[model samples]
Structures are given as structure tokens and as C-alpha cells.
Target chain A: MNASLFDILTIWLQRPNFIAFIILFLWGLYIMIAHHNLIKKLIGMYLVQTSVIFFFITVSAKAGATVPILLNGESVDPALYANPLPHVLMLTAIVVGVATLGVSLALVVAIYRQYGSLDEEVILKQLGE
Target chain B: MRHHLPVFVFLLPFGMAICMPLISLVRPKWCRGLTMLALAAMTGLSVMLYSHVIAQGPIRYALSGWMPPLGIEWIVDGLSGLLLPLLGSLALMGVWYAGPLVTEGKGSIHFHLLTLLLVSGLSGMVMAGDLFNIFVFLEVSALSSYALVGSAGGRALVSAFRYLILGTLGASLYLLGVGYFYAVTGTLNMTDLADRLPDLLASKAVMAGFIFMLIGLGIKMALVPLHGWLPDAYVDAPDSVSPLLAPLVTKVALYAVVRVMYWVVGGEEVGETLPILTLSSWLGAVAALVGAFLALSQQELKRMFAYAGISHVGIIVMGVCLGNPTGFAGGIFYLLTDAVMQAALFYIAGTAFYSLGIRTLADLGRLRGQMPWVIGVLIVIAISMIGIPPSGGFFGKWYIILGALEAGNYIVVGGVVGATLLTLGYFVTIFERIFVDSVSSGPAVLAESPLSMRATMGMLAAASLVLGLMSDPMIRLILDHAFPG
Candidate 1:
């Protein structure tokens, strides 16, 4: 339940990517759970997913490294290039996020067509459940 | 060719999935035949793969001859080898039962297409040796299953939407956890992670990472306190989809937990830094109790079975968390047998919905004498679920309870055994309503389920029976493949 000053400072300032990820994740979780409108809930989901994508990109970053490309005329030093695995992994994550958004949005459309409302309480009321 | 069986399990279905749209274009009718051929091949390939794994040990195939720590990898050990055949056959049976119910509506091809994709995703999840690859396959399976659940339209759409939110949340958390571990170990391969995790287990970041994965897969597995999406999804899913989604969706998540945590992280025994195992076993206990009690109050059969599923998942996880070979084997045994039994039960549920319009518990009273011999199969399955001897469910629980006793975890012991009595209460209530209680309304004569439907259900029920009666060899098979080298 308690942390040292070093831990606090690390969380607040040093680990920019992790701190930002935590904030965005909790914010999005709030919007997704507390919002009544289905569209807003989906927006919240997007924020959470984007936060994850950012975190992965953070993992791939290095201060003095070039892009993960091989130079035709130069010998390769791995440390000169930023890690590409995390970046490549994020591309797949981004596609999956978009695909899920599409599916959820289609479901929202179907719900609206059936019940004429996007508000959770309103739809549940209409269903009398 | 036999050596390629592991990759073939995933690629066959994926290739068939891509070919589906084209087949529908050239000849819509051929879609069904193509689907049957694809799954039959997948199942056959998996059976061969299982034998190979048993004989030759775990198979790890590196893509393009690149060895693990850098390139993508796929591994099928004892546990995954057993599950592949079971899930493949479930898909095969699911298609046969779904044959009559799948309407020739516009884009009927979507049904078969999504089914194949789901199977492919599931197989990929089972075999994936890379953490990020597992996440990708998890999404593929989740996305396809969403479309399948919402395929019935209307209320099903609403349920699917809610599941989407929770499912995406779960995936993001899982990815975050993977990132945390990668940060610590600088690797994503399971074998590499295991080698690095022991020393890092005491680090706060690694502990947090473990909790994140637990929460993430918890949502996916529909554990108690995080199961808000499951019952609604199951009840509202199309009858055709339930047979596939109900049995495999949560079961696979449970498998991921066992594979990653115990198989990779070395369970609680390997790392003494945290009592995360004990903590999870308690959570499983709570889930078992809460799920059973809620199931007791359900008036609809599908809804009841959904709650019961939550309880069984809890029991299986509890077994695995015991950190012993007997318990792990029991968990695997229950998982394989339960997939077959749940698939068969959902088929009967679909039959009732499609033909008899029997949705409520009261509607079962009319099935007294007029019902086809399918009632006999239902009795067999219900008895197994009730944990009677000579049935799969009984032996599964027996090993779990025995393991719990050995570990002195009385709470888990109570939860596992107490659920059996509650299970009896529900099954007896259903039977009493069917054969004993007098019907108040409904039709006097009942329509019979098709021979194909009846035949599939009978086969699965018999499999459950055989799984229990023949527990010795099967348990030995599981132990040999899944445990110490």
C-alpha cells in the first residue's frame, strides 16, 4: 500500500509510456462502463486499444537508433536500429482493433434497427428486462 | 506430411475460410460440401498429430527454418495435442447439427465462413508458441464468434455488442501484460520467457504482469465476478452457434491459463515469490458456488446450462491450480469431455428451440412420452453432468476433489463437492418436470429431432460415458503428454 519516493517519481515522470497507458486505460474503461450510449462505449474501447498500441510503440523506441531497415552499403550493428518486433506486433494489434470496432459498430447498427435506440437503459426498458 | 500436421490444423481451416467466398460465388451450394471436407480433413490431421505427439514428444516447428527466440514458432505439446482433436471433432459435429437450422438467408456463406475462421483461430491459439501470436489468434477467434452469436439478429445483437466491449478490454489487458513480460525478459517465446521468469518473478513489474494476464484471461474464460458477458451471450446466441461457442470459447481460455501459467511460468511450485495460485484457487471456489446457485434459479434450460458451464470452468481451473499432476490431468480430462458433452447438450437445446418451441423449464413437462428416443441421450448427459459414476463428469470431479483433499484446501473441496448436489437438484427437477409432473398446457404430441441431430448427440453422450469408464488409459495418456519430460 505504500511506495518510496523513487517509485512515485518513476511512475509519474520516468515511465512516460506506462503512465500514459495507465491513464488512458482507466479513462477508457470508465467511458465504456459508465456511458449509456453504445457509440460512446465504442469510443471508450477505441481509446483503450489506442493506449495499448502506444505502449507497444513505446517498447520499440530507442534514443539513438535508426529505423529497422538494412542499409545496402553499410555493415549492420543491431544496436544502431530500434527493436522492430514490437512495432511489427503493433501492426497486427491495430488491424485486430479496427476489425473488432467494425464488428461492434455493425452490432450497434443492428440494435438500433431493432429497438430504435442506442441508450442502454432505453433499450433494456424497451425489452422490459 | 504427418510432420506438418500441427500447422495443417490451422492452415487447412484458414485456407478453406478464404476459399469460402469464392465457392459461394462459383456455386453457393458447394460451400457446405467444402466446409465438410475442410473440417473432416482437419479432424483427421489432428488425430494423426495426437498420435505423433504421444509417440514422438512435443513438436516445435519454426517458420522458414528460423529457430525460436526470434522467428515465429508453433508448438503442440501433450495438452494441446489432445485438445486439437477434441475441438476439431466438436466443429465437425457442430456443422452436422447446424445443417438444418442454418437458413438460406442472404449471405448464408457467412455462417460457414465464420465457423471455419473460429476453428482456425482456436487451433492457432492452442499451438502458438509466441505470446503476441497467441493474442492475435485470440482476437481472430473472438471476432468470428461475435458475428456468429449476433447472426440470429435482434436481441442477440445487443448481447454480442456487450460481449464485444468486454472481449476487447480483455485482449488489451492481455497485450499490456505481454508487453510487461517482454519488457522484463526481452523475449516473447514461451520457452524463452520461462527461462527468464524465475529470477524476475520477485520483481513488482513481473508480478503486475502476471495479475494482468490473469485478469485478461479471466474475462475471456468467464470466471466469476467477470462473467457479466457470458450468460447473456450464451442465452441469446443462435441455437446453431451455441454448440460451437458454448463449449470451446471459455474452455480454450482456461487452456491458455494452464498452458501459460503452469506450463510456462511453472505454476505456484516453481516460483515461491507469490501465493497467486492459492489466491486463484479461492477465486475458482467462489465461481463454482456462485455459478451453481445462480443456475439453480434459472427457468430456461439454455440459461441454466450457461450458468452450469461457469461452474464447471471454475472446477477445471481449480484442479489445475492445485499444482500437481493428478489435478492437471483431471483438468484436461474434464475439459476434453465437457467440450463434447456441452456441444451435444446445446444441440438438443437447439432442437427444442427449432422444433418444440420449448424455451422454459415448464415446457419440458410435455416431453414425457411423446418425445423421441433423444430423451434417452439427454438422460445420459444429464446423469454425467450430475457426476454419476461411469460418466466423464464424475471422474473429472473425483480427481479434482482428491487433489483438493491432498492439498488441504477444504474450501475448494467443498465448492467442488457441493456443486454436485446442486447439479443433482437441477437435473432431478428437469426430469421430474418431464416424466413426473403433469403438463398444464402445450401440445400433446412432440415433433422428433432429425436422425442426424439425434445421432450426433448420441455419439457425444456415449463419448462422455466412455471417457469416464475408460479413465485409466486416458488419464495416463494425458499425464504422459502434458507433464514432466
Candidate 2:
């Protein structure tokens, strides 16, 4: 059991795409928390959403898989075709993410127009008054 | 036609919302009339659906004639059956109360459209049988609410922006959690996931998914630490929007939490395999105490009520985490009663602001004499908020206490009692200032609200009493069908 666990850990470490996705997700979260600029915060939000999209795409991929579309007269093995459901779901998610980004950008514009600053601290101070 | 009730319940509002902008261009009066008409129709349909569920069992409707795991399905079970009518009626009352307020606003047409859309989204969230569908509906409601909040402009814009950022982050987290579930179970259908989840309960991915989902929903429901956006959003939103949102948004989120826990995750894992329930119970206890204290410190009426809402949410969460039918029943009862009480209170605040042009407690200076009906209703609602007997709030608290005692959760029982006392402390102070104190020199000019607003407030205030009297039957219905052992 211990040896198998170690093998799984090693294999996971070698998956660079998964590692990159994790790093990007964390970096996006960090920027969302650490940045004061509202626009930059929205960019961070987009990055977080993009990372999830990447994660979904990675999960749907197979080492030897071909496109999911089938030929008219051919019998195809399911194993040779990549899963298409996750891709479709991610497409919906990407649209949702884009819509959310658009709304957030509009809100930022309104905030800037009102308060004359996009900095979190400045907005907070103004709101306090 | 009856078979199509589930879809019609949501589709009516959605269709009307889509047509509202065009309708408003032709006749703005028609827009308001159409919104109320849609709500009334939904209320009637929900009542029909609820009775059908009680007579039979769960009703499942597949979109486009496709079955579950392939096409989206809507389930009107005992839970949704109870909630649907509650949501529909409350929305009707909200619209009735917002009539004058909406007409006063510049974007009256848009406001009506968003309100309809929000109601559609809420109904969809409750009825949806698929996991991803819930997320979609949640975003629909969240996005519309953000726009509604920002429609008030000025400070509301900032508050709504904050809400949008945090709400989007929460929704994204929820989606990530859903992705985990999909990766493991290879299905998005809730019932299908339930069948697959038992064997995978011990898996790290499933556990991570549970935690992520909990945190995400916790933010949406404004559970203490993650509740930073709630007060600002509620207090800064427009008068009409505040009452509508205050009653529904978090309650719907709580409904989703209950649905996922009981239906999808199942109670066994929530009880035995993980300490999540216990942790939530403790978090709730702390939230109750902290929320009550924070509410006591606020001078603004709406802001104080927002904090008090957090406290009541804590109580409901504690009830749910007890992991028994009795506790679950208590949670549902509290949710229903709290919706009426909070809506009534916010309506009063809105009316007060509309009439007297102020919401600060200091400025309220004994105008109860002029607007006696408003003050009277306010007193009754405030008493209910403190969980006084013969009001719906009392029965909810009583059941929660009984459930806590049954579970031997003395700490939670103590927290509930303490929270009640704290509730009384703030509410009593407001009550005295309203009824007992002399009218101060401050602007004492009092203008009565419209008859419609008063009637809506009176009806909801009466509901608190009527529901309290009927709580035994209500609890029995909830336990026998909603949480059958």
C-alpha cells in the first residue's frame, strides 16, 4: 500500500499540466486577495476561471484518444474516443465566466465613476465616510 | 396541464421577464400588472403542486421528454413543494410592497424585469434536480440581485460590486466542487450522484468536494466569517430590493444546502464518516453569539436587521447540523417563519424611510403616535423576532431547543438561549424607543404609507401568529414527508 501511494504521488508530480493548473489557480487566488486595484482583481478572477477551464480540458483528454465524432459506417471503440461531456460542460462554464467578467467590469466602471478610484482602501475609506 | 406545473412555475416568470422590456416601451403600467399576474399564477400553481405532492409523492418532470442523467429534470418533492408556495407568496407580497417604490425609481421597468427574473431563478434553483442546473440558476439569481442592488446607484454601486466579486468567487468554488463530483461519479444528475457516492465516501476527492461546496455555500448563506458582503449588500440596496432579497436569497441558499446534504450526500456520511456536522454546529453557535452582539451595536435599522438575520441563519444551521428529523423539521420551520418576520420588518423600515425620510434609530423619535398601524405591526414583528410565544418564531426556536436537548447538545442549547436573550435585548430597546419614549424635537412629521403597503405588512405579521398556532401540524407534515425516516 505504501509503495502504491508513493507511486501515485510520483506520477502526479510528473503531470506538468496538472501542476501548472494548480499553480495558476493559487496565483489567481493570491492576486484576488493581495491586489487592491479593482480591474486587476477582475483579471485575477478571470485567471481563476481560466485555470478551472484548463483543469476540465485536462480531465477530458486521453493519451491515445481521437475526436469524439463518429464515422457514418464505422464501428468505433469507446476507449479510442475522448469524453465529450466535460468539454461541453466547460464550454457552458466559460460562457458563464465571461458573462461574470463583463458584469464585474461594468461594476468597476461604475465604481470608478462614483468614487474616482479603483483602490480597495480608498473605496473603503470613502464608504466609511 | 397539471403535469407541466413544474416548468410553468418558473417559465411563466421567465417568459414575462423576457417580454417586460418590450412591454414597458408600449405601456409601463402593463409591466407592473404583468409581474403581479405572473406571481399570482405561480402562487396558484405552486399550491396545486404542493397539494399534489402531499396526496401522492415527488413529481418529476423531464425537460424535452428526456429522462434523468440525460436531460434536465425538475423535482417537486415534499421539500420543494413546501418551499415553492412560500417563495411564490413572499414574492407576491414583495411586489405588492414595492409598487409605490418601483414607480418612484427611474428604472422602474428594469427593476420589475429583474424582480421577475430573480423569482424565476429562485424557483428554478428549488425545483432543479441536476447539480449543474442548480449552479446555473444560482448565478441567474445572484447576477440579477447584483444588478438590482446597483440600480439604487451611489453607495449601492460599491456594495453591489463587492457582492459581485465575492458571489462570483463563491459560485466558481461551487463549480469546482461540482467538477470534482463529476470526475468521480461521471454524472451530474443528483440522484445518480447519490447512488454513486456511497462507495466513494472515503475518497479524498469526495471529501474535498464536500468541503469546497460547504465553504462556497457558506459564503452565499452568509455564515459568520464569510458574511462580510451581506450587511453592506442588504443595507445599501434600494428599499424595494432589500425586502425582496432579505426574505429569499439566503433562504434559497439554505434550501440548496439542505437538498444537497439530505438528498445527494445522504445523512449517513454527514453523520458518521465526517465531523462536518459537528464543526458546523460549533461554527453556528459562535455565529449566533457574534451576530447578536454585532446587531446590538448597529444604530441603523436595516443594518441591525441584517446582522440579526445572520444570527437567525446561525440558529437554522445549528438545527440542521443536529442530523435528525426533529432538528431538520425545526430548521425548515425557522426558515419559513424567519422569512415572514424579516420581510415584514424590512417592509416597515422601507415604509418608515419613505414616510419619515430617515432610518436611524435616533431619528425615529416617537412617531408611533402618527403611524400607529406601522408601529403596531413593527412591535409584533419585533416580538416575533425575539421568539415570543404565539408567534411563528417561538415555535421554530422551541423545536430547535427540543431537538438540541434530544441530541444532548447542551452547548448548542445554551447558545440558542443566549442568542434569544440577545435578540430580546436589541429588539426591546427598539420597541421601547418606538412605543414608550416621548417624541423628541427631531423631525416628527409623519406621513402614512399607502394602503397596499400596510395591508401587505399586516398579512405577513398575521402569518407569524397563524403559523405559530399551526406549527404542530406543519412540523408533522415536514417530518412525515419532508424528512421521512
Candidate 3:
């Protein structure tokens, strides 16, 4: 039983990409929830987005697989090549991510201009809301 | 033209959204007519497409003539057929009415641009046949709304930021869910997912995908506890934005919910393999009760409508999640009426505020003369809100209650009746204050809203009555194609 548990743990830990994603996502969520600074929260959002993008890329990666480019005069074994669809989709997601980042930063600038601070607690207290 | 209807429905607006700013740069005055013409053209095309889809089966358009599983697909079926027309017209009417009120000078360009983008995004969302495509459109619509929500400046900027954060999180969760689905099946198309999903019901990935999707959509639907961003998003948006979004945004999200839950997940599988559907019904019931009570306690007019929208969302969720055909039929039809009713009420609020600075129940109640036209439309709204006969709202809740009865969910039935009674209570007070009370604090001779605002309000109020008359056919059409073998 002890040997089996260790094996299972090793299997889960083998995927370095998944592990990295979890850490990044959790850290981002923590900042979003725990940080009172608005800019910090924005950073958290970016981290979360990056983690998701990382996850998409990870799902498309394969062991011993070459890029999805078709070589001349070679019979195709689909499994021998990394999947290209998720990569294409992620490029779209990346554009969306950039757009949201731009929009949010614009919003942050607007908030700072009006309230003169980037702290949530301070702004709310100022509003007496 | 008919062959390309599915693509043209959204492409027209998206192309026009791009052009609006350019046109404003040169002939600024022409932007108004272009905006109206674009929306009108989209609405007309949607109606024509709906009829075509009804006669012929689903219309499927592949990008660049590439077939599905390789190229993206856009489909117009019975479900989207019904939605496109309703969403298009409501948007057209909303922007039309907003022109006189909120679209003033330099800012008008951005306003029209964002509104058209919203239209384009919603149209794409309605027609998108792939899960990832839906996500793309979802972000498109969401980004535009985030911009619109803050366009009013001042306090609205804060609400827009909060909405952006919450909305982005929800959408990302949905995208992750799509990744999970794609990882397992290697396909993003809805019909392909449906075919692949049943065999993998026991897979953990499938379970994760479904749960993630439900939670994401729940946030978008603003189902009770997840509704933190909703009230402020609606209440703090520019006056014109509120009228367009307040009535329409959540309903489009509901369209997404229905699409994913039934079209992608399949029917009996949802009940047998999942308890989340049941959870949705209970949460919906609780949200209905809580939201109604909250609306009852509000003094501000728009906030009250915002909270009430949450309540109706709860009812609609309960309706569609019943896992019965009757429930879907009822819940789906009810949302149509609810969307219309919501638009009518917000138009009234907009008209009142722009005309007489009316913001509270008492303020609206104390008005004496001059809104003779408004009084007639107000009666229609009050009738629909109270669930009386010959109004669309009445039939929607009736079917919901009847559906709840069929499902043996006594709690949901009570939620429907209880919220209705509560709404009746407040609406009556407003009426009594208006018609019964002798005191009059409104201006001695108050001026009515512009002709355009009044005309739009009248048009929407009249639709609720017509929708009630039309509910039977609508229900039948939904049943025929929405759940096909």
C-alpha cells in the first residue's frame, strides 16, 4: 500500500507543466482575494490568464512528437506530431487576453485619475460606501 | 444571399462596428443613420433567416468552404432562429431610443461603436456552432460591455472594473472547460462534442468540463450568490447602456446555458450522470425568493429592476433545468417575455429620468398629468409584472409553475407564486400612489420624453401582449426542433 501511494504521487508529480499551472493559478487567485491593492488584483488576473494559456499549450504537447509540419514524401502518423489545433486556438485566446489586459489597464488608469489611489479599501472608505 | 444568411447575420453588424468610427471621422452626422440602418438590416435578416430555417432544416455555413472538424462552422437552427430575431429587435429598439437620450456629440461615436460591437458579439454568440467559437464571441461581447459599463465615468468606472474582473474569471473558467472537453475529444464543435460525450460519461475530464462550464455560466447568469457584479453593472452603466444590456445581457447568457446543457451535454445523460442540474433548480428557487425580497426593499427604480432581473433569472434557470420538455418549453418562452418586459420597464425608467428626474417609487408615483401616453404603457408593464392574463409575462410564469408541478418541485412552484405575489405588492403600491393618492409633487406641467423614447416604450409594452398571444406557437416550435433525436 505504501509503495502504491508513492507511485501514484510520482505519477501526478511527473507532469511538471500541470504542477506549474496549479502553483501559478493558486498564487493568482490568492492575490485576487487577499490583496487589497487594485493593481495587485490586476496582476493576479494576468497570472491567472497566463496559467490558462500555459495549460492549453501543455495539453497540445506530446512526448517524442515533432512539430505538426508535414514533411515531404512521408506517410503521416498523426500521433507522431504534436496537435496544432490547441496552439491555433491559444493564439486567439492570447489576442483576447491582450485585449482584456489593455481594457483593464485603461480602467485602472481611469480609476486612479478619479479616486487618486489604487487601494480598494481606501477608495471604498473615501466613498463611505 | 440566402445561402450566406448565417454568416451575414453577424458579419453585417461586425463590419458596421468597424466602420462606425471611420464614418464618424468624416461624416459624423451620417453615423446615426448608419447605426440605425445596420441594426435594422440585421434585425430584418434575422427574421428572414428564422423563417428560412423553419422551412428548411438548420443552415450551416463553413468558413472558406472548409467542412466541420477542420474549419469553424456557424449554424442557424430552431433555437438560434428564435433568439436572433428577438435579440436583434430589442437591440435595434434600444439603440433607437438611446439616440435622443445618451448619444450626444464626441462621445456618440464610441457609444455607437461599442453598441454595434455588442450587437455583433451577441449575434456571433447566437450562431456559433463550436464551443471555442462561443468562447471567442463571449469575450467579444464581454469586452465591449466592460467598455460600455464604464463609459459613463465617475462611479460607473468602478463598477465596470469589478464587472470586468468577475466576467473575465467566469469566461476563463469556461475556456478552461472547453480545453478539457477538447483534450478528451479533440474537437470543439457542439454536435461533435455531443457525439463524443455520451461514450465518455464516466470520464473525470468530462465531469470536470461540465462542472467548470456550469459554474462559469452560473456566474454569467448571475445565479444568486454569484450575482455580486450584476446589480452594479446594470445600475452604474450609462443610461442608454442599461436599457440595452439590462433587458438583454443575461438572456443571452441563458441562451449559452441552454445551448451547453442540452445541445452539448444531451438530455437524459444530464439527469442520470449529474446532480448539478438539480442543484441549479434549488439555487434558482432560492435566488428567486431572495432577489424578490431584495427588490421589494429597494427605493431606487433602476436598482429595483436590477434585483428583479436576478429573480427572473432564477425562475428561468429553474424552468430550463427541470429536465423535462415542458419545463424547457415554459422556461424558454418565459425568458422571451421577461426580456421584453425588462426592456419596457428600463425604457420607462430611462424616459422618466431624462424627462423629469424621476428616480424613486414616490417620484414616479407622484407624477400627475402630462404623461398620458406613458400611463397607457405603464398599465401594460404593470399588467405583465403582476402576471395578469392577456400579457406575455402571465403565460411565462404560468408555464413555469405548471412545469414545476410536472417536475414535482413544490419548492420552485412556491418560488414562482411567492415572487409574483411580492411583485404584485410593490407594483400596487406604485399604482395606488399614482392613481389613488391625492398629493402631487411632480412639476405642475411636466413635459413628456422625446417622441422617439415614447414610441419605443409603447412598442415594447405592446410586444408583451403580442408575445402572450404568440406563446403557444413559440412553445411548439421550441419543442419540435430543440430536442430532436
Candidate 4:
């Protein structure tokens, strides 16, 4: 039991990628909530999405693994190949992220044209007036 | 040919939506006709599929001829069979009501296109049997709705932006949960996940996954504190946009919650192992009270109705969290009834805005004399919203109260009753304005609504009455087959 506990501790410490991913996610969330500018919010949204992508890629990684692609004449061993599903899924997620960014930017442009400000507080005040 | 009904129901709308831009360039008048035709066909298909499912059982179709655990699948069980027909009919009504209003402008084509896409996305969400596929369809629906809300321009732009930000956050959280599940189990199929989840119930990652998913979908369903975007999006949207969105979007999100909790994760874990259901029940009770109280303060008609919608959503959530078959069926019945009632109310509000320029209680005082038909329908819908006898809303509340009593949950029963009285309180204000107050002396600037709009509103109002009278059969049908026994 003690050995297993130590093993868990070692694995947790070695997984710095996961820690970085969480930090990036929280940082993005903070910007999204705290920033007054709409553009900054959109940028923060992009950062949040990027962190998710990074986490997925990190999850797909295996120690002592090679590329997922197969060599034509080589004998195949499944344990040596990294999982490919997360990469494919993240590709779709990236496409969805781009589409969302496009829509959000268009909306910001329209809001800027109408209220003449990108700050949410200014826009709300103008709308009230 | 009959086996492909699930695919065709969504595919038909998607195909028509994609073809709309070209059709608009050639003949714009045909755009409305085509959209109506597509929704009507989808309605017919859903009815046929529901009948088939009742006769046989759940139908699962594997995409590209690959079986489950390998390829994407679409399933039409009791839940989807019931919801698909409701969604199709309501969407058809939304389009029919918007026909005359959208036709008067240049952007009518785009409106029809976005509306069709929204319908397709909703249909896809209901029928999808895979978790990842649900996310894809969710994005499809969310993206289209954000654009549809902003299609009116002006103040709608800012509201739509807020919706976009929050909606994307919700979607991101959901995806992160899905990622966690994949990391642990490496499967996305709902049935497969259900099979694997029993053994993994003790894992922290699995627990975190369920928590993340519930919170994400909670925001989408507008459960109280996370409902900041709904009133603004509904109020500032175009007159035609609110009716389509107000009834369907949040309900679909709730459907997703049902699918995830009962199907993917299994209710035993959610009820016994985790405190999710108990927590949801408390939150739902609080939301029911808070939403109704907030509704009491709104002066505008649509904003008031929007708050009332939040209250109804809370009631349905509370019912589902009871973790019993009776409670689950009550939740489904309330969902059906609320969709009909809320859509009819929004349609009436839209009609009032279009025909009489009515926005507040004062504007409604003189409306009785000019537009008796619209005002009459509004009264029936308002009564239903207050859960009066002989209306669909009463039956929904009745079942929920019975379920809560059976579960020995007295606080929830009290919450339901208190919410009902508060609902009556707010709706009575509208009643007094329409029925008792004297007409103002100002000249009438608008005429009565077109025949199509009135006819659709009348049908929806009648549906509420009919559904109330037929509540027993509806409950039986939903209870017998919805969740795995």
C-alpha cells in the first residue's frame, strides 16, 4: 500500500503538463470574467479553448510510445503506438473553436458600430440612455 | 425506407437550410414555403416514428453500417420519440407564425435559413445516441441560435454577444467533462458508457466528470443563477425570434441532462453514491421561488414571461431530481406542457406587439376591445400558466406534487405550491389589466394580426387544453418506456 501511494505521488508529480493546462484554463477564465473589453474576452475564450486542446493532447500521450502511423513493412505492436482518437477529436474541436471565434468577432464589430465602444460597461450605459 | 426515419427527420431540415441561399436568389417567396414544407414533413416523420416505436421498441441505427462501439449511432426510444414530434410541431408553428412578419423584410431568407438550421440541430440533439455526437449537434444549435438572436440588429447584438460568451463557456465545460470520461473509459457511446460506469463509480475522475457535466448543462437550461443571458436574449431579439427560441432551446438542454444522468451515468450513482440529485432538488426549489418573485417586478410582457419560464424550468428539474419513476414521468409531462404553454404565450405576446403595439400592462388595457380573439387566447394561456384546473399546466403540477409526496419530500411539495401561488400572483396582474381596466383614449395605431398568426395561436391554446384532458395516457406512455427498468 505504501508503494502504491508512492507510485501515485510520483505519477502526479511527473504530470506537470496537466498542472500547466489547469493554470492556463484558470487564467483564461479570470480574463474572461475580469476584463472589460469585449475583444479581451474573446481572446480569453480562445485561450480557454487552447487549454482544452492541450489537455486532450496531453491525455493521449503514452510513455515510450512512437507515432500512431504504421510503417508498411514493419511488424506492428499496439502498445508502442500512441492513441490517435484524441488528436482526431481535437481537430474537430479546433474547427468548432474557429467558427465560434468568427461569430463572436462579427458580433463585437456590430456592437462597436452601434454603441461606438468595445467596453461592456460603456455599452450597457449607452443602451440604458 | 421506414428504418431511415431518424436520419431523415434532421437531414431534411439541414438539406433545406443549405439550399435556402440559392433559392432566395431565384425566388424569395418560395423560401417560406420550403421551410414550412420541410418542418411539416419532419413532423409527419416524427409521428410515424413514434407510432413505430410504440408498436415495436427502441430503434438504433448505426451510421455507415458500423455497429455500436465502433461507429456513431442514432436511437429513437420513448424519450426521443415523444420529444421529436413535439419539437417538429412547435417548430412548424413558429415558422407559420413568423411567415408574414419575416416576409416584410430583406433578411427574410436568412431568417428562414437560420430557423431551419436551428430545427435541424435540435432534432439531431434529441436523436443522437453518442456523447460526442451530442456535443457536435449542441454546437450546431447554439451557433445558429446566437446568429438568429442577433438577426434583428441594434440592441440584439449586445445581448447575442453575451449569450455567445456564456454559451461557449458552457460548451467548453461540457467538452472538458467529455474529455475526462474519455480519458478514463475511452468510450463515447451512451450505452457503452452505461455498461462501464457501474464499476468506475468510485473513481474521483468519474465523479468530477459528472459534476462538470451537470454544471455545464445547468447553465444551458438557465437554472436560476446562470440564467443571466435568457431574459435579455428573449427581450431584445426580433419579435419572431423569441417564440422560436423561448420554447425549445432550454428544453433541449434539459433533455441532454436527462440523457446524461439516466442513460450514460445511471441514476443509481447520481442518487445514492453522489449527492447530485439532492443538491439539484434544493437548487431547483430555490430557483422556482426566485424566478417567480423576479417575474413579479418585470413591467414588460416578454421579460415577465421569460422569468416565468425560468420558474417552470425549476419545477421540472425538481420533479426529475425526485429519483423515482413517478417523478421522472412528471418531469417529462411538465416539459411537454410548459413547451406548449410558453410557446402559445410568446406567440400571443408577439401578436399583441405586431397588431396593437402592446408591450406593458398599460398597453394591454385597451387591447380587449380591438383584438378580442388574441386577448381571449391570451387569457386561456395565462390561466394555464397559473396551473388552473382543466389546463395542461395543472396536470403537470399535480403529478409533480404527488411524486414529491410519495417521496416524503415535504419541502419540495411546499416549494411547488408556493411557486404556483406566486405564478398566480403575477399572472393576475395581466388578467386585471386585460379584463377589468377601462380603455385608454389614445387612437389605435395598429390593426389585428393576420389570420395565419391567430390560427396558430388558437391551435396551440387548444393543444394545452387537450393535453390536460389526456394527461393519464401521456404519463403512462412516458413512464413505461423512457428509462431502463
lDDT, candidate 4, B48-98, per-residue tens: 999999989999988878998888899999999999999989999999998
Q: What is the overall TM-score of model 1 with all chains considered together?
A: 0.97
Clash count list over all predictions: 0, 0, 0, 0
Off by over 4 Å in 2: A1-9, B104-106, B436-439, B442-446
| Off by more than 4 A, model 4 | A1-12, A73-75, B442-446
Q: After superposition, how far is residue B74 of candidate 1 from its true place, in Å?
A: 0.5
| TM-score (chain B only), all candidates | 0.98, 0.97, 0.97, 0.98
* For model 4 chain B, the run of ten residues with the poorest summed lDDT: B440-449
Please list the residue runs of candidate 3 whose C-alpha ends up more than 4 Å from where it truly belongs after superposition. Answer: A1-8, B432-443
The superposed Cα distance between candidate 1 and the true structure at residue B378, in angstroms, equals 1.6
Note each model's CA RMSD in angstroms. Answer: 1.8, 1.8, 1.9, 2.1
Model 2 lDDT per residue over B301-352, tens place: 9999999999989999988887777888998999999999889989988988
Q: Which prediction has more favorable DockQ, 3 or 4?
A: 3
Q: Per DockQ, what order, best first?
A: 1, 3, 4, 2
Estimate the overall C-alpha local distance difference test score of candidate 3: 0.85
Models 1 onward score TM values of 0.97, 0.97, 0.96, 0.97
Provide chain B's TM-score, model 1. 0.98
Model 2 C-alpha lDDT per residue in residues A5-124, reported as the tens digit of each score: 889989988898889988998899898889999988888888888888888788788898887665787757778998898898888888888878877888889899999999999999
What lDDT tens digits, residue by residue, belong to model 4 across residues A1-129? 467988987987898999899999999999999999999999998889899889889999888888856589775587888888889889999999999999999999999989899999999899899
